[model samples]
Target: MRTFIFLCLLFEEFHVRFLVLTTMSTISLATEYRDVRASEILKQIENGEDVNLTDCRIIGELNLSEIEVETVPNPKYSELLESGFFDGEDLKRYGVNKDLKVVESNIKIRNSIFENDLDFSNALFNKSLFFVEGNFTSTVNFLCTTFGDFASFIGATFGDSSYFLNTTFKSISLYGIDFEEMWVRWDSLENSLVFDGLTYVKLVRNFRNLEQFEEADAAYYQYRKLRQAEKSWILFQKEWPWISFPKCGDIFMWLTCGYGVKPFRAFGFGGLIVLSFSFFYRGWPAISLRSEEKIDRICRLLPERLQRFIPTIDWPNPGISRLEPNKHTQKVSFWDAFYFSMVTFATIGYGDWYPKDKFRKWVMIEGFLGWLTLGLFLVTLTNVTIRP
Candidate 1:
């Protein structure tokens, strides 16, 4: 019955998607852009032109991968250096002997759509680049690209995998981006990378506001892991023992409990500890109750009326009392050891089994460990359950 309901839900979802896709109207780009040829665009830039596609959509594949769009010189710099009165020799005689590198021209393509993969690998942009309301249907690559000025991808949609490996931007805006699956190597730029909480907070908020809790949790999880890694690395670099010890503890907590990302790991670790102590108890048989022979002093301390009322306390019969030590082997069996270990870890002092005087210190230590393990397990379980 549950399987039937799930199949119905899946079918309904697909039906809705099909209706939406078929009902949406198609957009044309030829009406807005005079020419869509790459050669024409390059030639125009070479002849001092500013190409702007502020709201155009491309219907076919737009191949701009590995293209050097930074070959265009800045208008201001060209006017100052390329005047007819200034010759190369005249400029060389002065201290201005540095090579004239090309300055990047502005390429604005806001509110656009690419029907195919958009590859911008190894591209250098000196001016601000805007992709507001832009949508790409296939993979988008910005690998090894350098942005000398600010870049914005606000309100953009990426339909497939997006790569930003080794990409550098002076300042970036990632507001309301429809992040499908972005591949990034943030550790390679750890020293220069700076991520403020605003963007990630907004991302999480946007997903949660849409009632996409699983997506929101995923984003938040990634955010937390990144934060932990960054902070842990910083702390691990400290040379002082006191300062570094806490960091080591933090790493250990992550490995054992996943910093509340995983609760089962903590449970498993605690279970292993309990089993190990069970073996210790099996070898030592640390627990035994006081015999009836030792109860004479207690009977003497009791009042006359109370002693008569509690006959068993006044003259305890070893055959009738369950609190007496077992008459079997001195060493406890595996099952008995496990039972006692569990009872001790729970701090339940059953009268039938009490720690022997010789092994009292070991029992105390085990009790302390049990307290810590149980406390950590509870806290981690609560965090994992309630936070997400």
Candidate 2:
């Protein structure tokens, strides 16, 4: 009986020990910061200390919204000032009389998990802010927050809606920013989405890596449109003092060129101008319709150089003399006038129909129009062809 009682007691002790170990493991895996406040976070940043919350699960929201960043003097420079490194004359030469002040606020929260909303709106981060592989379960706001130095959100996951309206970054590194469930307020930030230089290239690469071609294309298109509008706005601002000619030029560019984004629009406008000029050319005796005999007589009196400018007229001899209208002296029909206008606009100048009198001015204008639109079309076509 004593032997059996000893065996039962051993089993009971083992079970109790196993239960204690399991309970401790469960506690360790649970959320760490269930009662952490925003004040603690701000204090650390304000003291020029890095805030690292890697692999932590906070119970409540992590809010740092509208936190003011204070600039502090550089320690190295401060010590130099105390040691009198810059004497009176030396200070004047160096152009810095007092201690150099530097600002810094670096945050590193890689692999962290936030259970509730995370707000950093209107918070100024003077230095680096890393959120690599961070996961936010609820809404995350970064509206109007300025990252002065470097900011990275590589492989971050946002479960709910996120806002980055008016957010500014100096050196941002965005790779694998999953927006599948992140409702970023893109409409409000449309104009601000004009990513240029390296940022643009990186954004495209990131989207492509994520297999989101449509998003990348849309971003590229918006980038192009914004660039054109920005150019126009800068020009308009520069010529604001004497606005007459510049205003007219701006209007022309906007209506016909889409401020430079839509080159196909210029083609449509050119077609209308061609038709208008053709109708005008047909109305008044704007072109000279000389007879074949007159053309031959004129060519005979011209030098080689001048003859090249004038076209050759080959009259078909019908073996019998018929009293029909001469080919050269034929009246300009609607189709014939249109053809002439088109060739003139194309700068072909076939010399079959020559502009006469006041029509010469109109021909020159049409030539310029044709050249402008043609150049625009080529540029636009090339851009469309090569665009990613």
lDDT of 2 at 159: 78
TM-score (all chains, Cα) for each model: 0.39, 0.40
**Stretches of candidate 1 exceeding 4 Å from the true structure:** 1-50, 59-61, 64-103, 188-388
Name every residue pair that clashes in candidate 2. Answer: none
Task: Please give the distance, in angstroms, between residue 372's alpha carbon in candidate 1 and its true position after superposition.
Answer: 8.1
> Compared with the true structure, what per-residue lDDT tens digits does model 1 show for residues 1-388?
9999999999999999988776663333233533254455455445445667765655554444323333432232334367776655664453232222233666667777777677665456667777777887888877656678877787788888877755666777776777666665434333333345565665566556555555565566566666666664333435642345555666656655665556567667667766887667655546653444433343356467744552232222121121435554243334445555676676765554567777788778777767766677788678656754
Clashing pairs in 1: none
- Predict model 1's lDDT versus the native: 0.59
Q: RMSD in angstroms, all models?
A: 20.6, 19.1
lDDT of 2 at 39: 65
**Candidate 2: misplaced stretches above 4 Å?**
1-40, 65-103, 180-324, 327-388
Candidate that scores best on TM-score: 2
lDDT for each residue of candidate 2 in 1-388, tens digit (9 for 90 to 100)? 9999999999999999999999999999975543445567666765778787766665666665334454333333344456776555663453332322233657887787777888775455677888898777888877555566677877777777776644555665556665543323334334433234455455555555555554555555565454545553333455464435555565666556655556678877878887888777766666654344544454456466854663443323211111225333344445445666787788877665677766688889999988877776777666545655
